[model samples]
Target: MSGPVWAPPEPGAVDVHTHVVPPATSFVERLTATDPRWARLVRRADRDDVADVVVAGRLFRTVRRVAYDLDQRHAEQAARGLAGQVLSAMPELFATWAPAAEAADYCRAFNEWLAEQVVGYDGFYCGLGIVPLQDPAVAPELLAEIGRLGLLGVEIPCATPDAPLHDRRFDEFFTEAERLGLLVFMHSVGSVTEFDHAMAGTGAIFPARIGEALAGLIANGVLARHPGLRLLASHGGGGLPASVARLDFVRGMAPPTRESMPEPAATYARRIWFDPLVFDAAVLCLLIELVGTDRLVLGSDYPFLPVDPAELLRDPRLPDGLVDQVRSENPRRLLADAPGTKHEE
Candidate 1:
């Protein structure tokens, strides 16, 4: 392997990749203005036809969902599957969280509701709170309070094309996040400037656009600036692991070194972590090789991705020890290693 080989996690270890939809966030209530199909579902939580997904293939019921509300889902997860998931966030972050200007109250109410769940629940759940990136200025305090509440982290949307991850002003968010040892999760969203517009027509551009944005986060200095911040990219970190050879000018050479950036191939591969929900082993192997198994963590993209977390966690191709590491150890270390977790050096 190009990087140090890591061990799989022990039973009950930390799972940093699973995504969840806490009841308090009322994620089911918010819909993006761009996707009206989603709007109807928010209004009707348990829709038979309302099975819109927050992640790729996972669907939401008209009934509100709990981490393990579905016995089939739990049976799949309980085999010591992906440690935990980042749940669906409160809907307000999206442009369609509300029909109009009454959104502020909805936002406040949802945050309080989320707090109620995180504070009340135990073992089976962990919280990744939400913040409205539209008002980036207030994000730090939001993150700080979430941390104080002992939530796992905060979830923010992918950077809009108009607002790339490299914007240093957003550093305040990362800065406070770093101070509180909060994790910043980047999931997909809309911007006046989209990284990709499926609405424009056709193409699997989401993966490609994600690659550009995330690579910018690191190669462009976002990671370097907020050294203490911890971030997890959704959807296989979009496609960074797969794009390396292109960066190296190898098999599928890249377009033309967009910026004077480092051969992001090895750099990104080694730094950013990804979830195990990737449906292929060859890609999983390559990610392990490029990013090193240690940086790679187990992610189920649960309540979203259709695959069972256990099966993905135990990918046959991934070495056994490495699978253990991804399941829990790495996440435990990531969070416990954070300055405030009270872990010893």
Candidate 2:
């Protein structure tokens, strides 16, 4: 708890998971390029004037630019910032996410561009491909292209509000992902929509629903069948370890999920990896204790959550060397084990 609390992975150890929204891309680029003038501009723009929300409707009209400055220059700005941050925190690692929805062609363009723009940097970046899950038939082709591009994995949203992760339609996508040796990344909200998250605050904890869907997918035999396909849930799997019992208790009622595979709720934790964005030292310790260190990786949720991943790894609350594995080694293995990936850059 003394002396800087956490030192991010010696600059270049990639932060395995995070989101890149409009401003994030902007800020990241600005910071990475060390644009002093732009940095000062960002500093001034950084202040958020949170507006009042109507409690009943849960509506707020916050004033801010939704478009990121990075996108304007074909992400030239974002690349500069992200690359700098990766190098600054841990040059040994980087993060990845799938591209836009019209993936059949754009997916290829994005992946190739990503590899050329990012991964080709060699030790600078690696990526995952995003396919239009709405059209499963084309996914494999994109996955094939993703592999050809030397990208690391494919990112698919687990569930949207209209379609839960268990929706049979998504099964084909999972099957293809497994077949390609591509890992399935259930980006937290990918499992389900934010019906409850809208309630705000304290509701965020306890039986976190997103975590349950992730567990449900694994226990329902998704992971069982695709054992080789690396499956990871972002943001500490949205409280995965803690919700196991509850998930099991609910899933126990469904015979299909129960009979599919695995003995109990425990199987999901064993099969899937959880990113370290839980944001609590004690909770992180609990996750390691529940799922073991290998299943946990550093998901900084950077530029979003104020939490510093490097600091979480260094917390006195967890066992020694846990941080190193979470930040450096675990991700290395995750990317290493991913299929169709050629480990470019």
Candidate 3:
């Protein structure tokens, strides 16, 4: 948060958090008859640009063209002075609750389609793939496929259907992710069903789940075990920054926690990246203080909550050069290692 004013780079800021949904024609009929969790888009008769995402015969949520139309997404990014976006599958499509093989097949189709979608956008967009974490045994193969497809990395939910991220089952997957230099974007599905029961709500639960995932990684030594892993916590680390002191406090009193953890929870927290989507300048500043500027990236969660880079610059409490770092430089560093992706020098 403290540094000399940075000379503004060129106009293209990189948004690390955005999502895209594939057209229903791609998979709806193919999977709907057999797959209970298949999500299909139903166009709204009243509006041309919007549609409702339906799953299991239930209304999921509504989305606009920006969620799937690359042309419109590119235009919007240009309007906001952004040069690029890192797109991931909508968490709803994750379908982690399904059987492992079923989930893997669905993920494979989506990953290939998303990777192909990035080709037209080229330098303006990179894509993140998903793996079937329900069966950790299959994760490494899927991750390898993701790498083969030239994806920047994979989007991971806060927890599997029955296991937290820290469970031993995921150690191999994490190991492979580190070896591949893939970015692990840990985003909660915004469902209380994916996290601990105590952390529940419509508005507050999303961040709470993300915080829990971050804490679990640190406390369970996932970060320490795989130091080379590129991890990005969404929603500004989703309460981790605000609650780090409590994590440290607990570690001090619990001898077992200190013995098991390789370093202070806050120390591990700083080593990872976070998206600056806290929605409050003061909170963003605090996250900067906790994680340092190099680890904070711009994440608009585009289409759901499109953010303008100027919104970050408008805040006086933040340092003068932070916009360039969070919106441009840091994100480039995050995606630089991926094949088929572009980055500024």
- What TM-score, computed on C-alpha atoms, does each candidate reach? 0.69, 0.66, 0.89
Residue-level lDDT tens digits of model 2 in 135-238: 55676667667666655566655454345666666677677667777766666432112555533432353236557677667656666666666777766766
Model 1 residue 122 lDDT score: 24
**What is residue 42's positional error in candidate 3, in angstroms?**
1.6
Q: How high is the CA lDDT of each candidate model?
A: 0.53, 0.52, 0.78
lDDT score of residue 108 within candidate 2: 52
> On residues 57-98, what C-alpha lDDT tens digit does candidate 1 reach at each position?
222233234332434434455564443433446222443333
- Ranked by TM-score, the better of candidates 1 and 3 is 3
| Residue 116 lDDT, candidate 2, scale 0-100 | 50
Off by over 4 Å in 2: 1-12, 19-109, 190-209, 247-257, 339-345
Could you tell which candidate, 1 or 2, scores higher by lDDT?
A: 1
Ranking by TM-score: 3, 1, 2
lDDT for predicted candidate 3 compared with the true structure: 0.78
Q: lDDT per residue, candidate 3, 134-242, as tens digits?
A: 9899988888788878787899998876899999899999999988878888987655444344134434767788888888888888888888888898888877887
- Alpha-carbon RMSD to native, per candidate: 8.0, 10.6, 5.9
